[model samples]
Target: MKKVLLLLMIVIAVSCKNETKKEVKKENIIEVDKNYFPTELGKVFEKHGGINTWRKVQILSFNKGEEVHTVDLQSRRTVINTPKYSLGFNGKEVWLDEEVAGTYKGNSAFYYNLYFYFYAMPFVLADNGIIYEKIDALVFEGVKYPGYKISYKANVGNSSDDNYMIYYNSETYQMEWLKYTVTFNSKETSNKFNIIRYNKWKNVNGLILPSEITWYKKDENGLPTAPEESATKFTLPLISQVKLADSFFEKPKN
Candidate 1:
């Protein structure tokens, strides 16, 4: 009887140890997932609006001059309409319709989501398949801004070789500037980076979004020199929890 009792006690102890180990392991995994983003960039996302909040967004729309651009946040379907022309990506191909307007001039594939990516900034950088590295600080005028360099994994996007650098105000943790390389339609990557300044911002549905973005002329070293006379600006920014129907982004029939 004594031997049997001892054996039973030993078995209970071992089972409890195994259960405790499992619990600890599960907690460690949750911690890792919670902290997947680098510390600094994580703060940026929080300041803009938590990354999780941005992820929950189903649709986002904004206006650039007379053009209304709407994007399906989850599927990356996009549609842009102006008085003269309309274009969109139906998840598979980029289509342009100028029947009511006129002829379209720019490359449809490249321009489809260009502004959306730019407007979405720091939050978009949190997307999967992106690798982030700490980079040197950028000193513009007299202010010093810290930044991170972002690159995509192989076969991630239209241009995986393209690189982006995001600079933020260290004190506020708000993104202030962005530098990106144009590798579209190129087999090889380029080192030249064009800069855009994000100074004006507004809050829409708890997310910090750009109201006006300034483009600057590049110097000999390809860094921004002076603010361009014509800056790309946005208005009527909105975020929706409801996604548009798939047919909304489909090619228009005419």
Candidate 2:
């Protein structure tokens, strides 16, 4: 009877210890799922539209100023159609309407892509190769905004040299000011940075997008110390289109 009691006590202790360990593991998993795994940018994506939703969307269509832009988010394919020029990239290849006036090969491809990228915010920043870090609240236009700095690993894209500082509203978490380096040509990380203020935003199919994006050139000191104080660069009105066919991005036979 004594031996049986000892064995039972040992079994009970072992079972209880195992249960406690499992509970600890469960807590750890919950914390990781909530915090580190998703990332700060992931939180922003959830605010706009969950990454899964954007991933499920095969195509995103929009208009910026005079051009109609359609993007295949999954395939990374993009099409920019304007009255003057049409450029298409099927994720792997970028095609431009050569017969149309003022279409250069890589230049057109780069420009079309750059425009689309800036227009599609928050989500575009959620890309795989991006590294994000929380930065001190930015003091802009005499107002303060919570901000984060985003950089890319080498070979992230055509220009990994680029870096972005994005500021968000403290209460709403919507984006406000964006400062980015335009180093598309040089591999060096040292490049002049530009600023764009997100004046307004609109929601399309659950995707939060900027409606009016105002550009600002850095001051003579090469930094945007204040809002709208620097020479106002060209401001573009952004628009959105929806559900375009893949063939729209394909080259047409002239």
Candidate 3:
């Protein structure tokens, strides 16, 4: 009886030691990931509407004229419903309702999910593998704004080199201008950026989005202004019917 009791005690002691080692290992992993969590960018997300609230949202859709754009947050699938060309992505390759060939595939793929991402501000930027930095407000057009610059690490969607600089009004905490660059071939160099102003804003299903997005030509000093050639570069007026379900964004079959 004494020997049996001693064996049980030893087993219990080993189990406890294993648990402690596991807990310490888990804590060390969390400590490593803590650096990647952008606390400042999280404040921007909370200001708009907490990231947790946005996470609960399953589907978000908007209309730009006759075109419709929808995204499934859970699966990260996007669907662009358009009169001319419709697009669907099942989280991997973007499939089209019609068979696409040549450079059209690249063009279609680039444009299919582009504007939807723009319209889905703050929320879309909260994706995984994104790195954020709080920078000094950019002084432009005789005005200044608090800024957050976001970039993607490796394995971030199709393009990893793309960087976005979002400026927000300090008092209102509303996004003002978005400056992003297309570093297509070169993964490291970003010498130029096109700045677009968020002209109008509207709240849809508790998420703040830009309704009227206008493109601007940057001056030598990198100030954003309304382009002389165009009026409204992008418009997403019909913003409603936010729902959930990954099947909605899947490639439609006959």
Candidate 4:
């Protein structure tokens, strides 16, 4: 009788342990499913209309490295006002403010005159179907951000250098920083665009916008400092309407 009772008690204990383990497993699976995975960012981009199209942007830019230079520019500052042309600027330089004149002169000037076209990938990622790679998490100002490294590649006939990486904050889903490499005359130069720790996202014409932006180059410490080469800020106006022709995206004639 004693032997039988001991065996029964052992069996009961084993069964109860197994049931507890199963419950723990079930809870773990639920937690995994509940996580805000990086894939959800793709959905957010889709909901925001997939990048290539954004109207009315306001940007405040700053330079990194030696001295922190700043600018306050608006998009409507360079309105061409012609049926075919319009121009925009960021205080220091013109971004895209041109009307399709008899020739594609403004288009050419916009590309070669300023690096605006080269640096437009951050904004174009939504419309051009940008791809994201999971990178390390970024911790800033006491907040831990799940980071997704972002990049873009050009399609047929688009010579714009779209190869660059951007870091999106995990919690806010806002772009926190960008790292890019550009080749000039066979020499590759790397740059980082850093956010100076601020909240307050602005919505512009159905799209979200980051009001402040700063540029920096990665340093030996693996942290962001001010960028020395070229930096500027843009303050966009309230753009109620935009009428860009198809030719605006084409390359200018030689």
Cα lDDT listed for each candidate: 0.79, 0.63, 0.64, 0.38
Steric clashes per prediction: 1, 4, 0, 19
* Candidate 3 structure quality by residue, lDDT tens digits, 82-180: 555567787878877744433234466677778777777766777888766666677766788877777798868777888888888767767777888
Q: Candidate 1 vs candidate 3: which has greater TM-score? A: 1
Model 2, 30-79: lDDT tens digits are 12223332244455666676666665665555566556666667667777
The C-alpha RMSD of each candidate to the native structure, in angstroms, is 17.3, 18.8, 16.7, 23.2
What residue pairs clash in candidate 1, if any at all? Answer: 84-101
For model 2, give the 10-residue run with minimal summed lDDT: 19-28
Q: Report how far residue 47 has shifted in candidate 2, in Å.
A: 2.5
Model 2 C-alpha lDDT versus the unseen true structure: 0.63
- Model 4, 154-196: lDDT tens per residue? 4511334434444555654565555554443333333433333
Candidate 2 structure, TM-score to reference: 0.73
Candidate 4 residue runs with Cα over 4 Å from true position: 1-38, 43-123, 127-130, 139-143, 152-162, 187-201, 226-231, 238-254
lDDT of 1 by residue, 54-93 (tens): 9888878888987778888898998888766788899989
For TM-score, the strongest prediction is 1
- Which is superior by lDDT, 2 or 4? 2
TM-score for all models, in order of appearance: 0.84, 0.73, 0.73, 0.44
Candidate 4 TM-score to native: 0.44
TM-score of 3: 0.73
